[model samples]
Target: MLERNALTFNPGRDQDAQPVGSFTDVRELQQELQGHGIQFLAEADEGTTGPASFIVVDPDGNPVIVDQHV
Candidate 1:
């Protein structure tokens, strides 16, 4: 479902470092969604950081992107 699209997570491992705000493209948005989700709970357990923490889905149901900015 959500995995098939481009999913991006900012600050990657540095969630705490990410500034509190919502943004669309380079500009800022009105609301802030300060939360997180899991793609593969198993990998998350092993501590996968960088782009791996994020998950994007391909047309077929496979993860196309582990991380992306924007």
Candidate 2:
């Protein structure tokens, strides 16, 4: 069995890796989650724009990554 697992979300791309017409920014997502009291293992700088990423652990101890590549 795999001991570690991670889920990644790409804000500006679809499952096929095509750019989307519109999507929420990664920073916004991070802020919203933080507001909800979710803690992050790693976080992107909210001051910056464009490509960024942040990591948070799920209830099951799996890492969830929100990565933006716009």
Candidate 3:
């Protein structure tokens, strides 16, 4: 079966998945989602072990984090 926003396909499995890899694109994604009112939570640093990150509340107020480190 197919899934909306699915980033992975498991031929032998029943469901698809979206892994951290899906968020690895830092620049383009930032621009694309800007219209959605994305907010910055943190900036990326070379000394840091992971990519820059941010947190935004969804329509339901659930925290959604976007990180591009992979």
* C-alpha lDDT values of all predictions: 0.33, 0.94, 0.44
Q: What TM-score, over all chains together, does every model reach? A: 0.20, 0.93, 0.42
| Candidate scoring better on TM-score of 2 and 3 | 2
Error of 1 at 48 (Å): 7.3
lDDT of 2 at 69: 96
Q: How many backbone clashes are present in model 2?
A: 0
In TM-score terms, candidate 3 sits at 0.42
Per-residue alpha-carbon lDDT of candidate 1 for residues 1-70, written as tens digits (9 for 90 to 100): 3434444455323466554454332111101211233233122212322222333343466653333242
Higher-lDDT candidate of 1 and 3? 3
* Winning candidate number (TM-score): 2
TM match of model 2 to true structure: 0.93
Show model 2 residue runs off by greater than 4 Å: none
Candidate achieving the largest lDDT: 2
1-70, model 2: which lDDT tens digit per residue? Answer: 7587889989999999899999999999999999999999999998999999999999989999999998
Any runs in candidate 3 off by more than 4 Å, and if so which?
1-24, 36-50
Q: Cα lDDT for residue 47, model 1? A: 35
